[model samples]
Structure formats: structure tokens, C-alpha cells
Target: MISATLGIEIERGVRKLLDEAGTSWPSELKVLVDRPAHPDHGEYSTNVSMLLAKTLRKSPMEIANKLKSELEHAKIAEGIFSKIEAVAPGFLNFAIDWNVWLNRHREYSAYQGETEKGKVVIEHTSINPNKSAHIGHLRNSCIGDTLARLLSRAGREVEIHNYIDDLGNQLADTVVGILHTKTEGEHVRFGDFCWDTYAKVNKVYKGSPELQEERTRVLHELEEGTSSTAWIGRLTAEKIVREQLHEMKAFGIGYDVLVWESRIVAEGLWEAAFEHLQATGAFYKVEEGKLAGCWVLRHGGEGSGEAEGTPSPDPEAHQADKVLVRSNGILTYTAKDIAYHLWKFGLLSQDFTYMPFADGVWSTDSQGQAMPFGRGETVINVIDYRQEYPQAMVKLALEALGYKEQAARLLHVSYGVVSLSPETAESLGVDTSAGKGSYAMSGRQGVGIKVAELLQVMEESIESKRSRQEGLSSREIAAAAIRYYLLKYHLQTEVVFDLRQATEVSGNSGVYLLYAYARAGSVLEKAGAGQKGSGKALMEPPVPSFDGGALEPPERQLLKQIAYWTETMDAAVRQLAPNLICSYAFELSLLFNNFYGACPILKGPDDRVELRVWLTWKFRETLGKALDVLGLPAPDRM
Candidate 1:
């Protein structure tokens, strides 16, 4: 992702200058290059000369003049940079030869067909196997799927993990409520039944302390593992989680590994984990205070309260620790997670007997058929941000246990939740006092819309649009539009869940982007196809020399945006945010729209036709790549 071509030249200039100055350094001296915020400030600017001014005891301007003079004498300076100019603030600005952009355009365009398998561990849609898939789950999967696609395209080995919370308080509640309610012959999906049972039980327990106590009692039984209640509880949870996974697959979400909480607990991983922590001098017993009888981990932190240069509350704070094993000798939730994290990094000498739940949920193969189960090399946990502390603690514990490298490898990829629609919130009588503000979805009392129902609405909207749209197959139009809308927006923002806007078949919706691709498809059909006819025949054209002579302002801008593909892929990988890619797609779409409106691809006859056709096909290919990164399908008809 070279931001500018002249940057490569400028780095060489700086390297030669540094060597000439007899300054020994480590690695390549990285001079930060950027496109200046103001167009008047030239295409690319660097502040390295200014940065060295203080050490050199010379004015930045004096240093800049020397580099400007030296860089002009460099071999690669020809055609890459038209002129080198210095600003009053000691910054160096370089004007680029637009021909260099044409070269970048061709370079990036080659990556379109590049196949990949380089490995990535993507953990997403880790919905607590307690209830149904809500809007928040949708957000997680959409972002995760898009990221997986981008990484795979950029050539990465991707392994998806869908973790289910198989043992917890919610599991107990659903088991108690659903088991009592279900009749002898109900053929309900576990998640669907859990959804109904959870909502009903939640509705009752919210106002009644007695009902709440009953739910807690069931949880204790599950924890204690003695009562028959525990048996039914675990089974009910397993079934429900299975149903949720099934629906997730229906909406194009799949995971290579399906990790469960119950199996780890059964294997005594937590017991072994507790011993590891104790041996590392990271744990001690809490003999006093409210935490009596608890085996707590030492906890302290840096703040104003701590002495200067000392971590306050210190890792030695209270001379006590966080309780790894709780008062009743029952393990806390944190303990289980610690064991799981250790196993993820292969630090734990423990293993789970991998069993197929056969819950009827499966991942896809290369041929669009079902491919079930895969072993993973890395693990990601997609949980709510509140768990960031717990996750951090897991990392800290790993480091304490001397798995410092493993600690560094863990990623807590958090995203804000999708909120309830305002009217839905009002209709459901949502409590504004939860302090989570709007990002709360209460599955109990039936507060949230199911993902299936939401998709159904989208599908119907697609059908309605298809019926009205002329000369297009219903299936093609419906799918293209739906997938595009799903991929169009940034996933980090808390979507307001506007049912109307989500279902609306036009304007920045996924369908609209698909329509744009479809429109490009129509143009290609009219011209007897663009890429296969010319791209294959063009013979890579000696680094694709373009005159910039025929490039309109719009064409230049489009080319400029097109050149950002490498950055988009790299940025998304580093940041772990698909929103970055989504933003790129939107920008690319807007650029293509303007280019299509202003410049005619086939207007000029003869040689111009092939070049413009090549450009048009390139645009389609680039646009198609953008959509592909988002896992949005590019249908020819739509």
C-alpha cells in the first residue's frame, strides 16, 4: 500500500542522503509520506527533514533545501515526480507524474484475479447459545463474513469459529422453563424453543423476585451438577445453540470450529488451569474481607493513588487476588475462559474430544455445498465490549504464566451493538434505565426481532422490486440487492435498525450497489464482454503506460480511488474492522457512478474503444472486487 509512487523515490533519496552524511542507522529510515490535506500543498509531503532539524542544529528550511537539491539528482526521480518543492514550515512537497498513477492502476488491477490461502483465524457471531440471533448477532456476522472474504482475497488462510455459551445462568433458565413447557412431541429447533422460553421466563422474572430466585436455584443446580435439572439444562442449551447455528448458516454465516463451554468444564481444564495460575505465583488465597475463602489473583493498577513510577493498587494491592475458584469451590466464569484461552495458544496440556454435534448446521465447501468442521490454528472471541476487561485479564494471566507471545496474539475484536428501532423500543416499553442506553436487546419478554423475520422482510421487498423491474430474473435481482445492502455500511456504528430503510430497495442499500454492478454487466454485454476479450489479449502491456492525456478529471479521481485497493486490504487486516473495507466500497461506487455518468466508454471508435473498454472493464472488475470483499454477490442480470 504505497501511498504515493514518489514516496518510493523519496525514501531512496533520504537513504542516499543519510549514507552520504555518514549516519549509520537500523533498517530503512521510515519517512512518513502523506497526501497533503490541501490540494495546493502538492500531491505528497514529508516532514523528515524538519524532524532532523533540532538534532542537526540547522533550520528545517536549510535541511529541506539540501534534500530538495539532492532528490532532484536521483535516478528514479525522472517521470515519477515532476517537481520537488519545499514549504515554509520545512516540509517537502512532491508533485507526482499522473502517469505513475496509471502504473498503480494496472498493478492493483492485477490483484483482482489473484487467488489466496494465506491463514486467518476469524471469531465472529459468538452468540450466547441462550437465545435467538438478534440484530446484534446480525451485525457481528455481517462484519465477520466481510472481513473473512477480504482476508481470503488478499491471500490468507481463514478459519471461522462460532463459540456457544453452553453452560451459564441463561442456559439454566431456558432449561427450567422450556422443559416444563414443551409437550411430548414438539419438533422445535433448540434455539427457536429457547427464544420462546427465554422471553416468557424473562417476562415473569423481571417483576417477581421469587421467580428470579427460582432461576438462580436452577443455575446452582447446573453448577453443582447433582440435580436432574442440570442434565436437562445442558441438553436444552445444546439444542438451542444448534438451532441458532442453523439459522446463521441460512444467512451465509459458518464457522470452521464450534467450541462449547460444557465440554471444557467436563474435561477438568479449569482445574488444571487453576493449578497453573497458582504455580506461576499469580494466585493466592483471600483470607479476609468479603472475599474470604476465595482463591483470588493479585490485582492492582497504575493511577494517581500509586506512588511515583510505581503501579498503584499494585499487582500486590491488598496483598490479595481475584478469586479464580469461588467460595463454594465452584469455578467462576473467568476460570473457564482462562483455560479456553490457554488451550487456544497451545499452552495448556489439555484437549477436548472433538465431537460433531450434528446439530444439522454445516459450513460451506468451495463448490457451495456443505463442508462440516475444521481444526483451527488461531482463536478470536467476538463478545460485547464489557467483556474486554475479562479478556484483558485472560491476556494478563497468560503473560503471568510465561506465555507472553500467546498473550500478544489474542485479539478482542469488539463492536458496538445494533440498537432497537425507536418505535419498536417504544412499543416494547423498553427500560431506558439499563444504563447500556440504546444498545440493549432484551430477548426475554420477546423484545427483539428475529434475524429470520428481518431477512424475510428484506426478501419480500426484493421480490416486490423484482416483480416491478423489467427484463431481470426475480432470483438474480433479489439476491444482488440484498447482499449489497448487507455489505454497504460500516459495522462499528450502532445501526438504529430502521426496518423501513433496511427493506427499502434503493439508494446506498446493498441492492443499489448490486444494481451498479448489474448496470456495468449490461454495458459489458452490449460491448460483447470487456475483460475476457481484451484483458487476456492485452499482454500486461509493459506496466500499462497511459498518457493521462485522455483522463478526464473524473477519470483521474476514479483511478486515484482505484489505486487504494492495497491500502484497503492492509488497513482492514491490521485494524480488524470491515468498516474500513465498507468505506472503500462506498467511495469506489461513488467514483464509478460519476465516471459512468460523465465519460462514455464506447463513444469514440477505433483504438479509443479498446482503451476505454479496457478502462470500463477495469472499473467493473475493481467494483466487482469491492463487492466481493464484502461477500456481496455480483449477479449479471441485476
Candidate 2:
């Protein structure tokens, strides 16, 4: 909020100066303000003068001096900035009046007002209902769940959806394996059983043409939903989905609805979408060449909007047209997805009937009553980078059908895949003698760590490291560790998960964060400022007044960081990156730890004790909110 407030004042000053000079301001210029890396530069700095130099035909230094003079004299700068300086190359640095900042810091906490209207439909964790969820699937779920938390924290109406692709090849393979293969043990989980069965079926299909044909036949039967084989597919998919949900629930992830792929087809949604595409003439049957009899949507073509009979200047130069329906009449996944997105934006005429899938969650059902769902003003799909092309096709289809605004609102939060560090893979019984730095996971090869297995491992590891005096449960610590590990990296960076690093009690790990939070709570309890055995209930104390030039360097640093919480949330929302929240939380924890070491709260000098305690309380409050957004548990002790 400091950055925002400062940006507004700087913009106002620039406009006033330009108005007095009888020159119009440049509409393209943005007044960007950020914290200066060095304290000498000031608490916050902006380069607006540099941006205006080109338009004004003046040197950056001259523009900066003028702007600095204008800002220092403005009424708004009183009690907010101690000094405004014009530096070389057009930088205007403003130092905060720490007394005023400390007094009003709560006002700068993360914004809780709604910035957008209507519901946000976030589709994620759409794992195929075939095998147990792997680490890769865990990354997707963590990202999606955290995004839901972040959006909801910013006061948006969020609807979380877990799409079930039961009619896909993965489930069909699992069904075929169940009918053809024999197992030796009593299965505790249908999903765990299908995990191996799915791998076995794929291996066997490599050598048996007849088995391959059977997979194709099973796919058609699942789509038809009439035969006994279809029943097997449905039962297998539902059982596995329930198990997957149970697995995610262990990590505190849940969804608002389950949108099944079969229901999309059964409700004639894809049929309606096909008609809409055909009406636009962008979708047509290929009458010649290898694509004959197939329906396709031409993309990236030369003059793609030409009249219906006009030929392309260079057909081969255009990207390959996406197949909507094959010659065999099987709708491609893209075709169904187009229909699903149309329904997502409320552009389609039909809707899905919903039934209770779990506690407080709904599922699309043929025998259920119709309900309000999937009319999101913004649609975000949290999928991997591999699906980028298909996602783009979905957006392009929306645009081709004249829903340009909806197309623009459609977003794909694409992320890199999760792989295993060599040491982690070796611990999981994977051969690391090949000397590879990391190993990619394959579901078909059964070469990945299952979510349940990984969580159990993390819990045991954390329990071994903690003293008996620690009050938090191992499961809570494990969830925090794993969630933070997945979220601590840039979204596009491939996460090579190292279990040891994730569970470490020092240096940027979730366990470290939990320990810092517990330390803060301990301080608060010892000072009689926080309730015993409660993480959320803190005793309300009088706001501490700061004496001018009385604060230590560490205290000032922590206060400045705490005040940036709202600006941090704003950036995360605009960029759609949950990792930003992770980074902010980690940095905040470090700052708090540094302040606790250098400045005592309960034992400090009488004059500074109250201020330090209040600062500690503010740190705890800010960090607790961040932990909530990151979907990590806040523990009073750890």
C-alpha cells in the first residue's frame, strides 16, 4: 500500500507540473514505485522522471529536480515522507516517516476488497481416474489450491472445480487391465491397484495388436455408457476419483465441484458446440488429402477469415489445422474442451445437472437436479506446459465463434513438470547409477512417488527431527513442508523436489517458517500478549507509539516489509503467480527472525519493549495471513 500511495502522489505531482507547463501528460507512462534495495537510496524510489524525459525533451536530472521540488512542497507529502531527493539519471527517492508508517501499518495489510465481479472458475487437479496421484499431480493441485486461497483472500467469488476425465484413454486402460489381468493381493485402495494395472496394460498393449484394438473398443463403450464394459469403466473411474480426493484432502486441498468428461458428452454439450463452430464456417470437413472426412479448425492461416470458397495463398505455410472430430466420428479432446469452456463462460445454452459428490462438493450427474455452476467471468485452467497448444486452441475456438471478450478472459496457468532429484529418486528405490541430476516421472512406467507415500515419508522425517516439546503434529508439519516445497519456485521453473531440502529446519524451508511463527507465538505468550494453545487468538494490546529516530535498523526493515503486504498481494493477483506469495512469506520470516535476534521483546529496555512486542504481534498477524494464502498450517508450537 506504501508503493500504491506513493505512486498516486508522484503521478499527481507529474500531472500538475505538466499542466502548469501547458503540456499534456503521456497516457502510456506508468508511475512505478518500488522499495529501494539500499537504505541510503530511501525507503521507496521511482523513475517517473526518466520516463518523462523523452516526452519533455529535457534531461532526466532536470525533470527529477522539478518533480522532487513539486512533491516536497505538496500537502500530501506531510507526515508521510521525511525527505524527497532527486538522484542521477532521473530517480526520485522518498524516505518514509517511520513514526506515521508504524502508527498506520494495519491499514497497509493485504487488501480484502473485491476487485472484480462474478465468480472465478478455477479448474485444476484433473488427474485421469486411473492411478494413484504422483508428485507431478501434487504440484498441479498445490498451485491450484493456493491460487484459490489467494483469489478468495482478495475477496473474489471463487469456484474450485476438479475435472474428471473418465472417458479418456487412461481410464479405459485401467478398465481393460481389470478385466484381463490377475492380481495376487487383497487391494486396500482401488486407485493403488489401478496404478500398477494401468502400467501393466500399457506394457502389454505394446506387444499385442488385439489388446490395442480392445483399448479402442473400450474407449467407444465408455463414451456410449450403455454396455457392461461401460459400467466397469464408470465404477473404476468413480472409485479411483474418490480415492484421489481422499489423498488431496490429506494435504488440505478440496474442490467445490467435480466436472466429469462423460457428462459433457451425455448432455449434448459438444454437439451444441460443434453446431456453433459449423455456423461460423471456421470448422469444416476436409474433402481431400490424408485429412479427408475429418472435421478441422484452420488456425494461423493466411487470411484465415477469407470468404468460405477462397483458397489459402500458402496452405502448407499455415499451422496444421486442429482436428475436432476424426473420420471415425470420435470427438477429439479439444472438441469437448471447447464445449466445456463455452459452458464455463455461460456462452453455451446448456448446463450440467449437479449432485452432492462429497461434503460441500458437487458433481455433474445425469440423475441430479440442475444447479447454478460454471458461469465464470474469468476461467483459469491450471495445467502443465505440455498442454499449451491445446489450451491455445480452446481460446482460438472461442474467438472464432465471436466471443472475443470471453476468449481474452480465458487464462491458462501453465507450469513446468515436477521431477525427482537424484538423491530423492535413489531413496525411493529408483536406480541413480546413471548419474543423472534429476529423473522425470512417468505414470505409465510406474516410476513416480505417490502423494500418500511421499506425505508419509515427510511426516516420519519431520517427526524424527523435532523434540518431544514441540506441540504441532507431524502431519501438520509435513503438509506445510510439502506445500511450501512445491510453491517456492517460479511457476515455469521445473521443480526438482529434494525431500531433505524441503524438510530442513533452516533456510527458506516451510519447517523454518513454522519454527519462526512458533517462536513469535512463544514470545507473545511469555509476555502475556497471546493466548495459550491458540494460534489465531491474540490479546489486543494498545498500539505502540514510535519516537522519532528511536527505532533500530532491523525494526525499521521489518516495519517496511510488513507494510508492503497489500502491494505484494496486488502483484500476485495481477500476475496470477502464487509463488510470489511464497517468496514474500519467506522474506518476511527472515526479517522477523533477524529482528528477534537483534532486538528482544519481553527483555528489552522499558522504552522499546512495547514497540518490539507490538512489532512482533504485527509480524505474527501478517505471517499468519500469508500462511493461510499459501495453504500452509500455522502452528503455535513446532
Candidate 3:
């Protein structure tokens, strides 16, 4: 946490200077500690002086010099900074005492930061239980799982929830297809069969109004839970959900609870929420026009009042209204979600009974043992970017209910979908130039890579490359590669899934991180047997007292990055972004590889060898923790 200490010190100094000058400091302190592009500037630099120039009515350089002088006099800066200097514009450059820098490495471990307040409920992988999980679903699971790991590592109580939308139209279509048409072959899984037949029924509904009416009937019956059709839907959804859980388990993603949409409806949670919303004047019954008899929520519209009236003349002034309950007395998805969120934030009096679905895992039950699941102070929904409006409506409903504080705590962690690269699409026999630039996958069309199939393809690809390497399973390598690939990009960027790119050992893929880790492990093994001494013996030194001159360019560069591990984790948790961890892990690997190439470990002088080996051990520990947080395996060998 060197970066944190430096940033904190600089900000503290700026505030002190403002206090002495009898001027009030700004409430929001924005301090950024960034590495200078060139190494000569220093290990870390901050621009707090520039931020204070306007407020203090002084030149940036004048403020920077004054702050640097004051900081150098502070007690905490005695042994920490080797030199403190102010640059031209307003940069406070800090060079750490090499001796003190080596000591901080000893304090570094896997987990960082103190315990944070409140329990966090993260809902992810709410996939329709009608088909095998596609690559898009894999992205959601990987992102959510990694975020859970990140939060836990940073000392927060995290509860993982895999919501089941079993009562939705997807499962309804699958049930109708199962009862009316031939679904699945003799040896296929129910999930795979539903994936295909679900599409076929949707096509049937488009052509046959009779089939459409049957689908509507099936939806109502499934919600009401009193007919044979509803029983079939339940059985089918349960089977498919079991298969989906098994599939997710293959990727090392597990959930503490499984919240069912049907339970939310059946357990009176939505009924209580509807009554509360009605009391708050957030919902109104439409009496005229096409929407007559329906209850709608005004999501910022000119004529979207609680009282029934004519439509406004200026239609462009407001966004479209959101339907809560249809005229047919059926609640829309948005209505159910409002209730779900109320339960999440512990605002609703109603609760669900929980039953064990798996070992140490619970699912919502209508009449089972009651267990603690919801009542989270903070809830993060890991869903796709396409559902932004629905998520916004949930927050708006919270605000309209006068729970604005709870609404602020509800976060929508949205990510773009995973599509196929041109090469991968062509290889999968997909039409390349069909739609847009990147080929999007569709579960109903059965035209995307299944998670299972993608893993198999990646394993096969890796096996061909590492046939000579023993005790290295292709599946392990593929898991790391896929997880890293899905998380390496920004949340808003669509992933162009490519097998060749993902499996490349020299690139910024997960395989490269594994390879770098393996190389460090080998170095440790060689050092243990050779004259460099065992890792324990090398680490036994109370403080890493190395000859300052022995540290080369690469060694110093690697150490600088290693010092930022805790700082990186802190930022990742604060932003609720796992891509930051991916970027840090990749950069750390690159730095380690450079150090390994430029410096000799086993053949160097005694002191130099010890120092290099210790650095390798540090990298191994740091990178291993990062890989674990990313849900990627750090194999000893590749």
C-alpha cells in the first residue's frame, strides 16, 4: 500500500497548508498518484498542488514547493521517502528509501485492507433455465465470481445469489414445446433439448395465432401454480436449473443462495410490495386509451401522473411509461423485480423460506425451513447492458417509495455481451457478414458457442501446443485463459471471442500469466537446490538488506510494481470493477517476465542471487493471490 500512504501524506500536507493560511479546504479531496512515464521522475507523483492552485490563489509551482517543504518536515516522511522534490508545473515526486521499500515487501500478503461495513448481495448468472449456458453467460458468471472474490479479499461479507427466472416466457415456451412437440433425443440433456425446441416453438408462435394463445395460457398457468401445465413447467425448470448449476460448477463459480422468481410471486413478496408502491402513489391505474385497465409507473414523463387523465400534448418531453401490471391482472417482470429488490434491501416485511438445494447452498422454497438470505444493505446486480432501463426503473421505484438511501446503494453492474471474432465465427460455420461488424450470439437461434463446447475447444487447442509438458492439463489452462479473456476488457467493451487469441502463451491472455507463474516456480525450485539457498532461508532475513547498487533496472522496476498490489486491490474493490485486477495481473506478469529475462537468478553472485530469488518469491505470492481473485488457476507447471 505504498501508493496509498503516499497519496494520503500528500493530501494531508495540502490540507495543513490550507489550514495555516486560514482558508477552508474543499470537502472533496481528489488525489491521484500515478507513475511517471519515465523512471527518472520518481516511483510515485501526485498533482494535489495543481488541484489547490485555484483555491489557494497561488501558482502551482509555488504551492508544490511549499507543500514539498512541509511534507519533508513531517515525521512520517522521515525514513519513507529517500528524496522529496517539487517539479515544474505542480507535481510532488516521491522516491522511496530503498531500505524502507524492501521492508514493506515483508508486510505484503494475500489479503489487504480492513473490514468494511454491511453485507453485500451480488446477483449474477440469472440465466433462463431453458438452455445450456452460452459464452455470454460465461462472461456474467466470471465477472460476478471475480467481484465476489475481490470483495471478500478486501474484507467484506459477500453473499452470492444466482437468481432463477423459472417463471418467465423462456421456460413457458420450453414447457409448451415439451408437452406438444417431440423435444430432445433419447440421449440428450433436457437443457440442450430445450435450447433447440424453444426456438422451434417461438417460430411456431409467429405463424400460428392458436399456438400464441396456448403460450399465453401456459404463462398464466405457470404463474398461478394450480394446473398440470404449471407442474410440468416446475419439473422442467428444476431439471434444467440443476444442469445449469452443474455447468457453472465446472468453472469454479458457486452461489450461497438461489432465489427463484416463482417463489417471489408465490410467497406474497410481490403482493406486499405492490400494496406499498400503491400507497406511495408510484402506481396508477390507466382508464383510457390502449393502456386502459393496466397499472403503470411514471418513469419521468410529462403526462405520467398518478391520477388518470388524458395523454400530454408534448410526448417528446418525457420518456415512455413502464408497465407494472397488465390489464389481464398479470404482473410484468418490472413489477416482480421491484419486489425482489425490496427484499434484497430488507425493506419488505415478507420473506422467503429456504431449503437446501446443494451442499451448503440454499434456494427459495414456498413451504420449507426459513433461513437468512436477503436483507442486504447493498445489492449489486450483474446483468447485461441491454436491461439498463429495467434496472433504472427498479431504482426509480425505490426513490418514489421514499427509500432514496436504499436506492443509492443498489448498483447495476452492467457489461457488454460476448460475440465471436470473424475467424472464430467462420470456424464455427457461422455466416461471417450476416448482421453487424461483430457476430452476436443468440441462444434461441442456437448459433453461439456453448460454455462446455468452448472449454473443450480451448483445451484441445492448448493440448496441441503443450504436448511435451507433463502434469499440465489442457482443461486447467483453458479455464484460466477463458476467465482472463472474459475479464480483460472494459465492462462496456464487447468481447470478440477468439480461441487462438485466448490460448496464445506469449500474449496478454491467462495462459501467459500461468506461464509466467510457472517460470517463477521453476526458479524457486532451482534456487532451493543450488547455491542460491532455499526460499525459506532467503526469506529468513529479518529485512531484505540488499546492496542498493546490485539492483538492476529490471529488478527495481519489478519491485515498484510489486509494491502496488494492495493499492490495486483497493481500487478494484472501490470501483466494483474486476477488469482492473485483470489489467494489473497482466502488467505484473509482463514486468516479472522482463526481470527474469534481463537478470540471472541461479548463476549470479551470492547476494544478487538471494535478492533475485526473493523477488521471484514475492512475485509468485503476489501473482498467485491475483490469479485466485480472478478465479483462474495458478498451476505450478504449464
Candidate 4:
């Protein structure tokens, strides 16, 4: 980022001079740079000289020669570069002042102050409480938690949220099966015990119209919030959901708000939103036709010229008319969701007072209670790719209400669903059909592995390895290693949960990067507390005086990479891709490895040795900061 920002500064300086030339030229002069593909070409190179060569009607070499004089005259890289020169291809390259660059690196990292404050909401790890957490859920939590950490680190007010759909047919089938049938009080922990039962019920419903009717009836009971079956559904859901949230917390996934469907109904938030829809003329009367008994909103009041061109049935046709009033004169799920989202954005016509959830069984803070609803400048929903459309509809409804800005902020962080390899499915003690019913995770059938147990296993492995190798204070090691593993992958990736790959020290794993840090720390420690660094071990700096004349190309390349980190971070935030930072951190490790192999830190007591010590320490500090951003810890020992 320093490199790029410097380029901008230099351009502004050069452009001003051009404007003063006062020729009949374009009002704004353009400056261009194409960073070197290899460090051998210098840190950054530009062919802008050649571009102007043709316009100035001179050979590129001559123009480049002219430009070098003009640029040097500008003194942009004054203390930052050793030289600014022209390469054979008419490329202009600037070599930064090595001491200045080193000093900048030290000062830059020390400036990471406290987190800023402003309301921010991040929704993740919202795996259906009905089932256990799986690898997909793992990705969501890793990303969501890491995002919060990054934003919080950069200084923002952040609140985490998880939405649970406790009232639905998916939960009902399980409750119905449990109600009529009796099981030993022994709870089968396939998520909500009743929810797991739904999967079993779905499987063998064959040739039994009676069972089919029962499921349909149960779903109705769920929707209407009536019958003994509905009560069981609610109880089982609240229990299982809380446990799953606790499991997610091991990896630092905790939400401040827990919004549930039942509460939305109890408050009648949807009914008010429906009234607003009617007032806004967004809902219509379905007088007659196949949908006669039901109401429907024609896409655009007529029909989508085809919501695409499949000439497909309105996906919402089979769906209720979004039925604010079902044929039975009650709200449907679609209507409820529309209303809930409006309330989420505080756009609903009527407000619902927060009732601190009773039972105290599931909430946030010490008492296990969550922050009551109605907050957040923006809401992000992390869901499986399949739910993309419904989530989009939530945003669409907000957009329809003339809250385009909020709708724009209504992000759906849709990700690929997790599915295990056939071999893994069998290993987990289950027969998995490639498709019929075998999928990543399904709360419906009560299938999938546990996420918390996975993290615990990973933690134990790391702890045991350290216990045998070296003594690191437990907190430092745990925080660093756990985050490193979770952040190694980018979000939106649906990895086939592979245990062997997760804990490996090499092969692109977080452990390997930590190993690198540990090695660097050992070298620094052996050099003694007073060895060219602050003995306090606090990462504070005056200015580093490294001699760049001894820096190999790889060392220079490493410096260049370090310089772009702020830019990489800004890009990561803008693109919503955690992997960019993840990949960059690893690449930095690789650079350090090469630099260390070629340049020894503890081997010399000469001026160069002290310089190498300074250089290595600077590298470690920068790498450490980048790792922290990725939710990874920098270990003092491998």
C-alpha cells in the first residue's frame, strides 16, 4: 500500500508540473504504473514513458531518458528509494530508500490502535439449530467471526447475530413422530432430538398416505402455533439451538442477537408489515383462476416478462400468495418473512417491544440472554447457496419499500453447501447416497458431524504438539493457532471436511505458518534480549537502520510485498474475500523462509549481522500483524 500510495503522491506532484507547462493539452494528465512481474525489474515499473513516446513523436528510449530526468527532478522517492532509473524497454523504475522503507515498516505496524466504535452487525454460523454443525457451518463461523475481528480491530462497533427458524414443517415432522411414539427418556442428540426424527420420518413414508396426511397436519399445527406437537417443537428447538451456538463459540463465533420466528409471530410484526404492503398497493386481490382461493403478487403487478425465460411456474406460485391472509385467514411464512425483514430494517409500520426471552435458557451475556431486536446499520445473512433467492426476496421487499440504501446494505453472504466425500460419509458411520438424501448437512434428517468437537480436536493436537516441543503460555498459543487454522481458507468454499488436511504442518496449513513464526522467534530469542532489538519484547520502534545494499532480490521483493499490505487489506474489505489476506500472509511466510535461508541473522556480529537482525525483526513484526488480521496468532515457538 505504501508503494501504491507513494505512486499516487508522485503522480499528483508530476501532474501539477505538467499543468504548469500550460500547453494546449488534456486538462488532466494520466500517470500509469505496472508493477514488476519479478523483483529483478525493480519494485514497481511503468511504461508510461513509452506511451508518451508515441504522443511526443520520439523513440521510447529517448523519451524514457527525458522522463527520468524530469522524475528525478521531482524528488518523489527522496529518502525512500536508492535510485529512479530507466530499464532497456523504456520502463521507469524507482528503488525506495532502504533505511526509510525499513523505518516506515516498523512505525506502520506500531500504529494499530484500539478498535473504532460504530454499530455493525455480522450474522454468521446460523446453521439450522435443528441439526449439528458441519464443515459448511465451519466456513460460515470462520468467516463471520474473522470479519468481526477485523472490523473490530480496525475500530468499529460490532454486534453478531444468528437467526433461527424454530417454527416450520421441518421441525413439525420430528415433533409429530415423537408425540405419538414413545422413546426412552434417553435423548438422541441428532441436533434437536425431535428434528432428527423428521429425517427418519421422511425416509420411510412410502406407501403410507396416512403418514403423509399426518405430516401435513403437523406442519399446519406448527404454523398455527396450536397442538401439543407444536409445544414439543418449540422446546426441542430452543434446546438444540443453544447447544449448537455454544459449540460455535469455541472458534469465537457468538451472536449478540438471536431472532426467532415464533417471537415474530407473538409480536404480530408481520401483520403490520402486511398492512403497509396493502397501503403501498404492493398486494392485490386474486379474484379468480387456478390461484383463485389464494392471493398472489404478479411480479411487477402483471408477471415477470418471465422471471427469466424458462416460462417456469412462478416459484412463488406453489409458494403461498405470500399469503398475508391464507385461505384460512392467517399469515403464511412468506408474509411473515417480509414483515420480519421490514422490522429488521426498522421500516415496519408498527413496532414490537422486546420481551427479554423467558426460560433464560437461550440468550446472550452471563444470564444466557441476547440483545433485544431492532438494531444494526446493516444486516448480513450468511446462508447456504440454496437459500439465495429467499434471502434476496428479503432485500427485494426492503427495496420495494423505497429503502434502496438499506436494501443495498442488505447483504446475503451466500456460500456453497458442504457435502462430504462418499468415503468420509462412510467413515462418519453412515451410508451416504451421492444425492438422493446424502448431502453436506441436513437438520431435516438429523445428519452431519459436530463443529465444536472438531475444533476441540484441533486444539488438543496443537496443544499436545506444543506441550512436547516448547513451553508457550497457553493463551497465546491457543488464540494464535486456532485462528490461524480457521482463516487459512477463504469463505464461500465448501471444503470436504478432511481431518488429515486440517492439522498438517505443511501443505498450505495454518500450522505450517505458525511453525515458521516459531522458528523466527527462536532465532530472535537465541540472539539475546539486547540483540539489536528492544529487550522488552514490546513491538515498539524508533527507526530501523537496515543496509539495503546487502538485501538480495528476494529481500527487496519481501519489502515490496510488505509495503502493499494496507492496500491488500482495503481490497479484502471491499471485495469481502478473506482469502486475499489469507493467501498474502502465507506468501509472506514463504518470502521470510527464502530470505532467512539466504541471509543469516544470528551468524554474524558485523554491521551487516546487526542489519540482518533488524531486517528479520521487521519482517516478523509485519508478518505478525498480517496474521492477526486473518485471525491467526503469531507463535513464539512451533
Summarize candidate 4's per-residue lDDT along 1-638 as a digit string, tens digits: 44555567556644553455543334444666656786766666777666655455667777677667766666665456678788877878876676676656645344343332446677777555555666666777777777776666656677776766766656666666666544344554646355446566676466556877786777667666777777777777777776776666555455666667776776677767666666443365554445545543333421344432232244445343343455544455566677767776667655544334332323422233233455557766666677776666666666656677888877777666666655656766656654433346555455665565556566676666664655454434554454555555556665565555565556466766776776776676665524444434434323446567766676676776777676667666666667787888888888878888987766765665666565566667777877776666666655
| Top-TM-score candidate index | 2
Work out the TM-score per prediction.
0.81, 0.95, 0.93, 0.79
Clash count, one per candidate:
13, 0, 0, 19
lDDT for each residue of candidate 1 in 58-81, tens digit (9 for 90 to 100): 788988888888778774445556
Q: Which stretches of candidate 3 lie over 4 Å from their true place?
A: 19-22, 26-29, 55-57, 76-78, 108-111, 183-187, 301-319, 529-543
Ranked by TM-score, top first: 2, 3, 1, 4
**Tens-digit lDDT string for candidate 2 (82-137):** 88889987898987777777666666564855558778999999999998998899
**Model 3, global lDDT:** 0.81
* Models, CA RMSD each: 5.9, 2.2, 3.2, 5.7
- Most lDDT-accurate candidate: 2
Model 2: lDDT equals 0.85
Higher-scoring candidate on TM-score, 1 or 4: 1
Write one digit per residue (lDDT tens) for candidate 3, span 471-535: 45788777778888899999988888876777676678888888898888778877773333442
Which wins on lDDT, candidate 3 or candidate 4? Answer: 3
Error of 3 at 616 (Å): 0.8
Of the pair 2 and 4, which is ahead by TM-score?
2
Could you tell me the C-alpha RMSD of candidate 1 in Å?
A: 5.9
